[model samples]
Target: MEITSVLIYIIVLFLSTIFSYPFLKKLKWNSKSIPYKLPPGSMGWPYIGETLQLYSQDPNIFFATKQRRYGEIFKSHILGCPCVMLASPEATKFVLATHSELFKPTYPKSKEKMIGPSAIFFHQGNYHSLLRKLVQNCLSPGSLQKLVPDIEAIAISALQSWAGGDVINTFHEMKKFSFDVGILSVFGRLDKKHRENLKENYCIVDKGYNSFPTNIPGTTYHRALLARKRLSQIVNDIIYEREEKKILEKDLLGHFLNFKDEKGQVLSKDQISDNIIGVLFAAQDTTASVLTWTLKYLHDDQKLLEAVKAEQKAIYEENEGGKRPLTWAQTRNMPFTHRVILESLRMASIISFTFREAVVDVEYNGYLIPKGWKVLPLFRNIHHNPELFTDPQDFDPSRFEVAPKPNTFMPFGNGVHACPGNELAKMELLILIHHLVTKFRWEVVGSQSGIQYGPFPIPQNGLPARFWNESNNT
Candidate 1:
């Protein structure tokens, strides 16, 4: 067993190094246009580029090394492609907003691999517009208000399960709650049995997102393949069940069933399922990660905690004796709570690098970017830039207490493809964190006590927290 484990480790490491070694040639590319611009960064030798630094988990090292060498906005390679690093607000806005049409993400595998090709996250052109329209319509403030009771119920029940003041993995807890909330909002309860089946089916696609490229037995990819099938089956069955009964509920799945395209061809059941799974992937995982870091920051900073608590207490008491649970109004009223979540998002975003495909040569800041060059905008670099954000390393919610600090903050991303579920995710984080701070307190353990990342980046430590009732705080 020991030998086998060592061999797997050696093989994975060997392949990783080989994967990165080819890009050294690209290092010779000239990028003198924005030599003295943007936040500092680098693209290392060959194909490895900045990704090797990304794999290092400590992102600051990438900037620390790059800032010391390349300054910023220089040519570099990442994910095995030669790309330019753009960080300033003007450059970023140009890519995400001004010339967004020219730089849409058309990568086949990016949509198919990270998120399924058909999922809303990867959809482009008219299809992207359609999916965004559906999501936006469904997630409108009026609809979200109705989801309050549903969200509150799930949150309360989850919190109740943390009975023993136990050392809880806040990250996993958040993921589970988020998954439940997202599923319910998207599909409705329908029935207890149907909901259970849908949840089971959901995991198949979820697992696929993280699987290796290979889809063979004994591989995580294989499990993901099976999971995707199961997830699809569950959604299909729900659609079939609803169709058979001539019943339509207001849930996301039902909404899709009733949707019509420009040509008026009804969306098929699989299409609906695929979009839900896609949105779920975007909403659940990212929100869970943000919440995990929010807890970490709240636990580490006592003043922030007290401030959040004070705000929450006032909000909770204002709606005193109301039996339907804290309404959406109550949740949004917690100013400090929202600020902390926003700050955490700025500090640690699950999506740090955004990929864009260039359709034509674009000129900016005196540099002509050739057509077809992959655009890689460093999301983290701008957000944590000390020049834009004071004492960037520190977790201070007050920085965002007013408005976002311009180019330095784009957590859900920016412009056209920015997460449509941004409002929903923010609401969930604020609501959940509000409940956690009032009900319990927590602390980190071990070297990994703080935040960490994996692949798309998640809290490496799972954000361990010691939970307790408000009585303990007293």
Candidate 2:
């Protein structure tokens, strides 16, 4: 009787173990798979989510404070969306370069409507590739070489206009200069009347770009929409004229007009018009802002300004004291001036951050970034990192004498969506600075210390300043 009872107990124990083995295995696997937690930091209040806090203070301070407290990657809600801010170079590259397919560029719908939805920056895949190729082709090195003389002419004209001893808003004047250069690239010497029309309507659109997005009559945004329609009409008129004349030149518009896909599908008028306006929009503000900052920096640091002038003056003398147009080779060879531009880009960090939306739940550094959340690579945070840059706050062009780490210096951003117009922008800056420093001197007027953001940070009151022709003084 004892042996039979022992046998029954052993069989029961064996059957129980067999039944529980699969359950135990599954539990272990589940624990490993679900271990990730959301990153650190405050999401602010429930609905508005720190939008007020962000706008209420200097944006750089807000970001820098957060970085100090919460480390490189942190969670916050802004503009009514949950976001994970990536301040480290590795994280930035992961989102923007390595795993870019997992994230898509995101912008406010109002901005898309303002800039037109078909713009290259708003897209990915084949459509974006097509537009980017066309843009790159027109702005290529060879093409830019051809544009040097024209850009020089525009730069000379701009400096002359600003040299009348008026306390002009430097940022505003720079905007006009950049707009003309933008026009030259897009249309290649557009007629004065069409240029004026585009400028008038574009200014209205610019005013409403950051305004509240409401279609109610008389609102800034509403007026902007009307202006946008008129701009489209103007672009269409130009297209018609080009077609009628059979004008085929190597400009942005020419590239657009000449494009035909393997399917023989050419870009539509809306595509062309939207892109033209988009290029103008892209070309104008950021370049103007950077140029404004360059002036402010140079004005504040006279020693550095003199150094830049010395470099440019040598080149100027070579060109017979500005009698000859600047050559592409001369522009390319301005090493010190190039470093100054690099330092300025780093110091200003004009494109502070860019927005990307996660298309899937992503795991990074053992943190869970849930799908449908916004991910912003804080370019400003990276640019201002003390570890990455020694004395990051101090304006030092010499730091750029050695190249920045792979992804650490992204003033123009990085990865596939990097600015195609960056070279042209650099060329514009080089030409403008060469002329301004060699042929002109300027004095900053008013309080020279505060910053204001007209959507882009500019010195307070647009760095009110007077410029004088040094040649005239001589």
Candidate 3:
């Protein structure tokens, strides 16, 4: 009996060794790879960790709860990796500017795959700088001045379409408007069918950027991949056509075709296609989110709405009976309109936080952000902090009359990685609001609700509203 028991124990031990070796090996590798002091906080559950709460919960609540217990900088596992969340302005500046080289841009695997390797966010150092310069040339002040007329035309047409409607989804309309702006301003003019097709593919791709990474047939990620393939094919066809026709146009695509890098090497067909996708990703939905929030905020405040209307009315009155589309000077000169956009962005906090991963294990304020761990510069936390903005939850555009304290109002981000499209986005919003308030007015259909914070800010129920042309006064 004793001999039989000994054999059973040996068999059990041998089976456990075979089953556990791989996991143990990985565990050992992780420990050795990040053998440095970690910041203070919990890692939560074993595998999934704090990702669900950090991403799925109300951002203010999540950060507040964590901050209460763990203080300003805390360590946790989120978005499938270990992360150190930096909630203070100093920390934000450190990662975004001061020691930015130690932390490179990183996104969820799903986002990286969807945006592609050629996207600016995927590059670092010199390559990123060069790509940014190329993109900046396309969206430069000179280019924007030329593009304003087209933008105003699109905004006017979209508002006209919204006329005579009882209830419309403000978010959906803004999305369509922004998408059309991308099609025209980035790719130049296209036939309606081609434009619609591109919009459809982009919408599909946008839906899955923050989705699970699984590629099963029925998954959002799978659909996103398919949509991306279709989008690539469309872009490639345009590139070929432009090349064959020797089209020397002035839009973004034209700039790409003519762009010669420091080595005198222009972007290849695939590179151009990927970067265009990046432009659309950066420009469209994020602008839509801010626009929707602007509508919601304006509709809720009649006094503020009238003030905004007056500003636009003056601009229109200057245009000799509003006959000409808005000029770049007109758009740039709307101080109140600009302030309102800034306030809406601050209130909505469209981009909750941005992620950067440590390329080398580094120490900040005595806390260690280990190599490969993500560092979250908490934008929303800073935007909503009462210390930063008085009555932070109040919808007040006037607060932006004075410039926000440095590092405290970074809706478009700050430092080296600041969004190249920031000026263009602001111009788009200013133009859209100018048209909306001057030509049309909208009222909320039902009770206005709070915003939902995912990767973007979504107004509850898409902010359904009844629209009226100012002439009709209905």
Among all windows of 10 consecutive residues in model 2, the one with the lowest summed lDDT is: 22-31
Better of 1 and 3 by lDDT: 3
Better of 2 and 3 by TM-score: 2
- Give residue 2's error in model 1 in angstroms: 16
* C-alpha lDDT (0 to 100) for residue 241 of candidate 1: 80
Q: What does candidate 1's lDDT look like per residue over 305-333, in tens digits?
A: 88888887776666662343777777667
| Clash statistics: count for each candidate | 9, 0, 0
RMSD per model, one decimal: 4.3, 15.1, 8.5
Q: On residues 249-283, what C-alpha lDDT tens digit does candidate 3 reach at each position?
A: 88888887888876898788778788889888888
By lDDT, rank the candidates, best first: 2, 3, 1
Worst-scoring 10-residue span by lDDT in model 1: 33-42
RMSD of 3: 8.5
